[model samples]
Target: MGEVKAIKGADWKLEIGGLTELMGEKEGPALLFDRIQDYPPGFRILTNVFRTQKRAALSLRLDPNLSGIDLLNGWRMKLRTFKPVPVSVVEGGPLFENSMSDGEIDLERFPAPIWHEMDGGRYLGTGCCVITRDPESGRVNVGTYRCMIQGKNKVSVKVNKGKGGRIAMEKYHQAGQPCPVAISLGQEPSLFLASMSPLSPEINEYEYAGWLQGAPFPVVPGPLTGLPLPATAEIVLEGEIPPLESKDLPKEGPFGEWYGYFADTTVGEVPLMVVKKVYYRNDPIILGVPPLKPPNHYVSVPLGAAALWDQLEQAGIPDVKGVWGFVYSAQTGPFTVIAIRQRYAGHSKQALLVASGARAGAYGGKFMVVVDDDVDITNPYDVIWAMSTRCNVREGVDLVKGVWTSPAEPAIPPASRSPRGYTMDRVLIDACRPYQWLDEFPQVNVFPKEYKRDLEKKWKL
Candidate 1:
C-alpha cells in the first residue's frame, strides 16, 4: 500500500529481475509489473516491497515514522508482547477463483521470473511461505524457502537441513509417507514477514502473523492437501514431497544468496515436489524477493538482530544498548555488532562469547564486534571507528574455530563440507574501552549534539 510504480512489457527473463535489483539499489518504491512479455495483462509480479524502513514498519504494523535502530527497537518491544492469535478458517475465499488439478496443473501459466542470470531456473516462490505440519507434533510451520519451477506441475524446494519444514518433511519420509505441503506464492505482508522471521520451532507462523496484524489470519483448507491456505492469497499450490534417495533428489540453487554469492548448486540434494493442485485469485500477483548484493538487503532494517538482542538478555548479559547486523537475514549473517554499557572487566568479551554461541546469533556469523554504548552499532562508520580507536588487536581480538555456519558460506571449501554439518570460524573484537582503565580512557573527540544545535541557532549567519 506504499509507493507503487506500475510498469509494463518487462521480460520474465532478466528484465524483471534486473529492474528489481536496480530499483532496490536506488532505494526506490515497490515495483508492480504488468503486461509481462508473453503473458496476459493480469498476471503481475511485485518486487522491492521492503526497501525502506517506512514500508517495513507498515508491514509489521508498527509506527511508520520510526527508522534505524529505533524502528528495530520498536519491533523488539512489540515481540515481547507476542501472544498467539489463532487463524480463522473459512469454507472458501478469493484464492479459489481459478483452480487446476492433476493433469491440468500448469505452473508456467503464472509469471515466474528468472531472478538472476546464472540462477539454475525461474524461481516461482521467493517471497512465498511453504507450509508443512510436523508428523509427530502435528504443529504446522510456515517458512520462506526458494522454490524453483522444474516442470508443468513440479518445483524443487530448497528447504535446508535443520529448518522446521525440512525436519518435518524428513519425519514424514521416515514414516514412508509423502510430506503434505501447501505453498502460498503471494499473500498478506504480515504473513510474509512472519514466514521470514527467526521464530522458535514451537511457534506457529500463522498465529504470529495474526498477532502482527492485531487480528486473526484468515485461511481456507487446501482442497487437495488439507493444509491451511491464506484465504486472500494470490496464488497457492498444494503438493507433497516424497521420500527420495540422494540420487533421486533434484538439482537446485546456484541462485544468488543473501551473502551476495551464487553458491554452488546441489547435484541431487534438494527435495522436489509434485503439485497436485493449483489455485489462484483472478489477476494474481507473484511476490518476487530476489536476493541482491550486501547493503541492499531484502528488508531495509536488520530485523533478525532484534531476536539476538533478546537472546543476549536471556543469557544474562547486562546493559546491552542495541544489536545490529550487516548482510543479515533471519538473524544470522557475516557481521554483527552489540552495543553495551560495559559493566565489568570482562563484560564486553562475555557478551561477544555468548552472542557468538547463542541460537539467535551463532548461525552463519563471521565477525562479532562489541562496543561501548556511545558507539552507534547501526552505522558502519561509527562501529568501525570504535574498533580502530579502542581495540588493541592482541588483547581485544579472539577467534573461535569450527563454529556454526550455513552452506552458503563462500569461504568454506567444498571438499571440507559434509552432509553431517558445516562449520566456520568466528572473529570476535572488543571495541569497548578497556574497562579497568575506564577512568583514564581517552574521551571521544566529537561535538555534542546540543552544543552544535545552539551554535547553529546563534550564528544565523
Candidate 2:
C-alpha cells in the first residue's frame, strides 16, 4: 500500500525480469523496473497503480468505499483552504539518476510494451502528460494525449480536435513557431489523475495536482521548453511540434478502445514530434495500460463521469445524486447516465437538458439517461429496469439534434461535422413511487434481515 520511492540501477534487470513474470501471472504490485535494455540499469518504471478500486482509493488516501466522485468532491472542498507551492528546482530526484543527451537517445530500449495488437505502435506515453504552452497567453497546459513510439527518438502524438493540446499547437502554428513541449513519462499517481481531471481551461493541472496531493507537487522547469514537469518523472522528453504539414500523416490507431472494439478509422492521423532531447533515470520503466472493453479500472469513462458530476454541480443542477459514464459506450461512442433526486415535476427533464448541454456531454456523449435517486446509476441492471418499467418512452424521451461533436468520434457523420451534434434521445424514468397514487404500485418483496442472516448461517451446514 506504500509507494515505491526509488530503486537501484544495478538491481534493474532482476526487477524487470521479476515484474515481467508477475505481469504475466497477474500478480498485484506496482512494478518499478530500475532498468531495461540499452538504458542504464537504474531507470524506473511503474505499472498497475490503478488496477483495482482499492488501489485507486489508496492512491488518493481515501476510504475504500469512496468513489472517484466522492474523492474529487472532497478534494474540491479542500481547495478553498489549500494552496499550491510549486517547486522551482531541487538538488536531485530519481528522474535525474541518469540523463541522456541528443545523440544518446533511443526510444526502443525502454520496455514500452506492445499493449494491444491493433495499436499503431508501442505507446510510450499513455500514462503520462504532455506539457505545452499557450503562445499568446504564456499559460502552461497539460494534456493526457496518447503517444506512440515512432523512431529512435520520435513519437507520434494524438491531440484530438478541440483539445487543449491541439489548441495550443494552433496558437504556435498561427505564430509561425514550433510549439515548445515537454512529455513526462511517469510520476506520482496524483499528477496522473490531475492530468485526466476535467479542470477549468484556465486552471493549471500542476496546481490542481498539488491541491490533491495535499502539497504542491515537486516540479522542474523543462530544460529546453521551460514547462513545469513532475520533478520525479521517470522520463522527460523536451521537444517541439513542427508546423503541421499535409504529408506528415502517420497511420495512427486501430487500438482496442474502451468500447470493446477497435476504434473505427479509415484515415487515422495525428501530429508527430521530432525529438530534440530525451532524458531519463538510469533504468526507466515505461508505464503502459492498453484500453480494452469495460471494467478496465484505468479506463477513461469512469474518470470522465467524475468530471461530469463536477461540471453538472457547477452548473447549478440540483439533486444530482450521481453520474455514470458508460465505459463500454465510450469506445462505441459517448453515452452517460445520471441519477438525481427529482425535486419537483420536470426536474428529471431539466437535469437531462443541463447535462446534455455541458461541455463534456456535448463533446462525446451520444445517449443520456436520467433516473430517480433510488436507482443506482452504476448498476446497469437497475438503470435498465427503470428505463423499462418507469419510462413511457413517447412521453419521457426528449431529443436534441445537431449538437457539437468531436471529430475523433467515429459515429459522427462526415456531412454533419461542422460543430454539429447529433440528436440525444434522453429517457427520464421516475423510479420513485407515484406521488399521487403511491399505494397503487405493487410493493417489492424482500427477505427480512434476521431471516436472511439465519438462512445464511444454516446453509453453511
Candidate 3:
C-alpha cells in the first residue's frame, strides 16, 4: 500500500464553501479544492482520513478484521511499554516554511469551509485540539472544540459545557484574566486519535499521543500561551480567551452536527480568541473533517463501539466475546450487541447490565442485545437470528428509564434542557441448545467433510 501524503499550506487550496457542500457530494476519499480567489492556487484540502476499514486499520497498524476494541487493546498494551519524550526545537522544519504575523495574518485567505448552511460562520478548526493549562494545578488539557474565524486575527470558540477547556476557561474567568490557549492542526493520525479519546483529567494528550506513536511527540511551547504542541503539526494558532462579559457576541451554529441533522437553534455567548501568532511549516496542510449522518465516513460508530467495550471491561463484565455497535438503527444511533460465554443462569443479563452503563453504550446507544457465545456479535445476521429464535420480548427485555443524557442528543424532550437520562432496554437471547435436552433439538443436517470435498472435486459445474 502507498504511504499517505502529508498536506502542507504552501501547496494547499481552500475551495469548498460549506461542510454540507463538500461532504454531501463526495463518495469516497475526498480531496476538496478549487483554490480561494485571493490565496495561492493548487492548494489541497484533505478530508476523511479513515474512509474505509482498511484505512482505519492502517491508521492503528492492525489487520482490517480486528475489531475497534482490538485496536484499542493493542494501543493499551503498547502504552504500557512506552514513554514520551519532549519534542526538541530543530534548526528548520516544514511548519516554519511559511510565516504569517500582524498585518499578514488573514484567516479568510484559507478556504475554511462553512460546515453546514445553518452554521454561524466559517469554521477554521474541527480536526484540531486546543491545548490549555490550569493556572493553579499547572496540569494541561487537550480537547476537540469547534472554532469559527471572526477576523484576520480573531476566532469564536465553542467549548461544550463540562468539557476540560470550559473548566479551564472558568478558572480564568473567575480571576478576571485571559485564558491562554494553543490550537494544533493537521497533526499525525495517532495524535488526532488521542485528542478524540476520553483521557483522565489532567492527563496530557501529547503523552498519550507519544504512547500511541511508540515515541515522544515533538513539542514546542507556544510563545504566547506556553502550551505544548506537536512540532510536526502543519499549523498552530496561539491565542487567549478574554473574559466572558468583555468578549464580543457572535451568531454561531445552525451547523449540521453528529446527530444527522441541523442542530436545534441555540444562541449563546462564546469566547473570542485574539490570535497572538500563527505558525506553519512550508506548505502547511490544514485538515477538515465534516460530520454527516450515519454510514458516513466520519461516523462515530466504530469509536463508540470501542468505547463500549472498554467500559464493559472496566465494569468487570465477564465472558465477553465481542461487542458491536449496530449501524442500521437511527434511534439508538448505534445498537450495542454483546456475545458472552454463559457461566451462570443470568450471565447474559449481567453482560447487558455492564453494557448499558458502559461509556459508549450509555451515551449514544439506545438498544442493547446480549447473545450466547455461539453467536458472533460482529455479524449482524447471526445476532438477528438469536434475537428471532431465542429472545422473548416480554421476559427478556429489560428497560431502565431516566438515565443521564446529553444536550447534543435529539431524543430529549424540549422541556428537559438539563441532561436527561432515558430508559435502556436490554434483551438476552439463549441461542445455545438446552443443556439437558440434546435429544429435543435435532442435529442440523450437513454432509461430512470428506463427502463435501469429494463432491466438489467430482462436480465440474
Candidate 4:
C-alpha cells in the first residue's frame, strides 16, 4: 500500500482496486490496505494481503521478483521439504496493553469497514484466525472463518460442519463442555497463511510458520482462553462458544462469499462467539481479509498443489510432473490440473481418480483435467489448449456422483440441495492425448532451442 501510495498518491484506490480484481492483471503484487474509508482510522485493515503468486513468494522467504508459475512452483518445491519449527510460548506482549473485560468488551469501539458495497455487515474477523482445541485429544487447531458483527461483545462465526476447527469445537460441545477460543486479530503474515492452509491435526500452524520464516513462531497462552495467541498480535479476542442445539442460535451471513456469491443459507443458526475479553495494543491494526470475489489465496493454492502432488506420488501414480490449484473465481478454485505421462491403458484415469478423490482436491472440484506431460498445467492458456485439442469429450469425459462439495457451488441443481449439506457431481476431463496411439500422434511446432539460444547469446537478447 505504501508503494502504491508513493506512485498513485491521490489515485491509489483506483490502482489498488483495479489490480486486485483478479490474481494478476500485469505482474500482480500482494496488496494490503490500512483502510479504504476513514470511518476507523488507525485500526489497520489488510486487503488482498497475498493476492498474487509473486507476493506470496515472500512467505517462502523467496525473492519477491519471482512471479506467476515460477513463484508458485518455487513455493511448492520448498514445501516438499519444509519442516515446521515448534512455537515458544511467552508470557505477554503488546496485545495485553489495553485489556477489556466486564461491560467494556464491546465490538463497536474499533472501526470495522464495509469493504465492498454489497457486504451484509461490518466484519471484524475477516483476516482474523480462530483458535480452538479438541477436548479429548488436546490437539490445537487454527483456522480463518467469517465473523459477522451481530451485537456489542458478540459475533457469529461460520462453522462449516466438516472443518477441523468446527470438528474440534463439536467434540467439546458433544462432551457438554464450553469450547475455549481466541481470535488473533493480526499477527505475522506467515501465521495468517498457516491458518488459511489445510494442515493435518498433528502439524500446528505455529511450527509450520516458524519453518517458513526460518525462525520460531512466538506465541503466548491467553490469560482467559489459555489457547495459544500470537505474541506480537495487534489484538486478541478471548472468548468461549457455548454448545447450542438447533434452537435459537445466532444468525450470520447474507454476506458476499469468496465464490463471488452472497451466501444466503437455510440453516440460519451458525456458532456464535461471545467476547469475554479483548486485548490490544495502542493504535492496533486489524487484518481484514473478507471473502472478496476471486479471493486472494497465496498459501492455499500453491501449498494445496504440493500436498496433492505428494499424495499422488506416494500413492504410486507414475510419472506425475506437476499440479496447480487455480484460486481465481473461487475460494481456492474448484478447478485443478494434473500433468502426468501415461504408462498404461488406464493410467490417465487412475491419476485423475486418485487426485480428485484425494484430500488435495477436496470439496469436489468443478472441472479437473489430467493433461499430458507436454502441457504446462501452470499456464491457463496451455491447459485450455490441451483440453480442446487433446481431449475427445465423449471418449475422455466422465463424472463421479455424490461427492462432498461446498454448499455454495452454483452448478448443483436447486432441487438436489437440502439441509443435509451438499453433494457434488464432479466432472473429470482426461485432457491428455489418447495414450493408445502415442507413436502416431502429431507433434507440436516449436522454434529450435539451440538456434534461439545462440542468437540471444550473440545479440544479448
User: Candidates' TM-scores?
Assistant: 0.98, 0.82, 0.80, 0.89
Alpha carbon lDDT of each predicted model: 0.91, 0.65, 0.64, 0.72
Residues 1-461 of candidate 2: C-alpha lDDT, one tens digit per residue: 45343344422323443443344335355556554554665445666666555566666556656654465454335444546555446545777767666778887766665555555556777788889988878877788877877788788777776678889998888878888888888767777776766566887878878777777678876677777767888788888888866466566665555455555342425777878777776556566444545554453226556556767888888878887766532221366788887666667777778877777566656677887776767777877887787776666776776565545455555565432223333333344444444458666476767898898899973
Task: For residue 410, give model 3's deviation from the true position in Å.
Answer: 1.8
Worst 10 residues of 1 by lDDT: 414-423
Model 4 steric clash pairs: none
Judging by TM-score, tell me the better candidate of 1 and 3. 1
Question: What lDDT is reached at residue 65 by model 3?
Answer: 68
lDDT of 1 by residue, 1-461 (tens): 54899989999999999999999998899999999999999999999899888898888888999999999999999999999999999989999999999999889999999999899898999999999999888899999999998899999998888789999999999999999999999999999999998899888999999999999999988888888899999999999998988898777878988899998588778889999999999999999988889888889998889999999999999999999998887874889999999888899999999999988888889999999998888889999999999999989999999887888889999799776668999999999999999889987789998999999999973
lDDT of 3: 0.64
Runs in model 2 lying further than 4 Å from the true structure: 1-45, 65-88, 264-268, 299-301, 328-333, 405-410, 413-442, 445-461
Residue pairs with colliding backbones in model 1 are none
Q: Tens digits of per-residue lDDT for model 4 on 363-446?
A: 646677899887878788999999988898998999987777776676677788665567776688999888898788888787
By lDDT, rank the candidates, best first: 1, 4, 2, 3
Task: Rate residue 300 of model 1 by lDDT.
Answer: 96
How would you order the candidates by TM-score, starting with the best?
A: 1, 4, 2, 3
What is the Cα-based TM-score of model 4? Answer: 0.89
Q: Measured by TM-score, how close is model 1 to the native structure?
A: 0.98
